[model samples]
Target: AVRIVNKRGQFMQEAVPVGEGSMAAILGLDSDKIVEICRSVEAESGEAVQAVNFNCPGQVVIAGAVNPVNKAIEALKAAGAKRAVLLPVSAPFHSTLMQPAADRLAEVLAPIEIKDITIPVVANVTAQEVTSGEEIKKLLVKQAAMPVLWETSVRNMVAGGVDTFVEVGPGKVLTGFTKKIAKGMTALNVEDAESLEKTLAALGK
Candidate 1:
């Protein structure tokens, strides 16, 4: 439940490089289909495009070079995709294009000591819980260019008896995705003072 915002770090700083990347959200398309779309676009355009985020069922985000991303959007739309919209982001995060950033991040993290976790931390790269500090450090580096297995992580949590999700961030994006991921689950968010009060009221706290 760690939120990294307005933070200065090698990973965050390197993930965003100027003018060489773009991202887009592809809705109403299965993960496999989106992967296919990305592959096709990359092959045709000779540029990189990869599925970066599995937000929920039928909702994935792709990232790569700007031209190829645009190409994929057009191709996806032509292939009967319900929506393919460009995201307002500076870099093609979680794609192979970010490998350089990941490499730099690994160096930066090498000296930082990671403490053993008391609770299970689900990794974005593996969609599984990791407890070893070393493993966590490695995964954090890899996650820069690796697809975020958010859907799998959520499903795993649900299967493990998690029925309610509270998003503590600046936006309700994750809350919306949670609802789409599990219809029977409860999703709530607290992004501001008002939202905090509302969440507290809902929780009867």
Candidate 2:
């Protein structure tokens, strides 16, 4: 529903640690519940892992904590994952471990040139629409440490008259997120050729 053009350098790469930890869509559950589950698993596995992606109303994506994401890795193994291991992104992203990264990002942004935003861009930091490029940059740095406010962002998009949510790029992940956050709002993706055709056809209607 939101489109923030990657300022020259930002890029969306495939998520590393693809099948390492077990990430289940724990529906009918809140973020606190998911954090508890991650804690439970971490207690059993002696690893530092916690909920990473707070995507929607009832879903929470668990990632590494501290001890290790070994317990989740084991669960994935039992679920037929061919390979599983810890991720290699310095600190466990989205966790408190990234506080240092956030600090580093802040330092990096302090001297970077910032321009005004020409279009509406949804901010993951505040889950609000940000029109000032400087604010957008600041938000991006803060997002390195703060939790992603995807649900609120999606809600804002719907409230702002964006009836159709089109996720452009690979994967139906965002599309699924739109469904979870705004149940009545329809979501479509352009991940593959078939999906693109279907999306185009739907748009024509």
**lDDT scores of the candidates, listed in order:** 0.84, 0.64
Q: Write candidate 1's Cα lDDT for 48-101 as tens digits.
A: 999999998888999999999988899888877899888988788888887877
Candidate 1 has its poorest 10 consecutive residues by lDDT at 1-10
Best by lDDT: 1
Give every collision pair in model 1.
Answer: none
lDDT of 1: 0.84
Where does candidate 2 clash, by residue pair? 47-67, 47-68, 48-65, 48-66, 48-67, 48-68, 49-64, 49-65, 49-66
For each candidate in turn, the TM-score is: 0.89, 0.64
Specify the poorest-scoring 10-residue window by lDDT in model 2. 7-16
Best by TM-score: 1
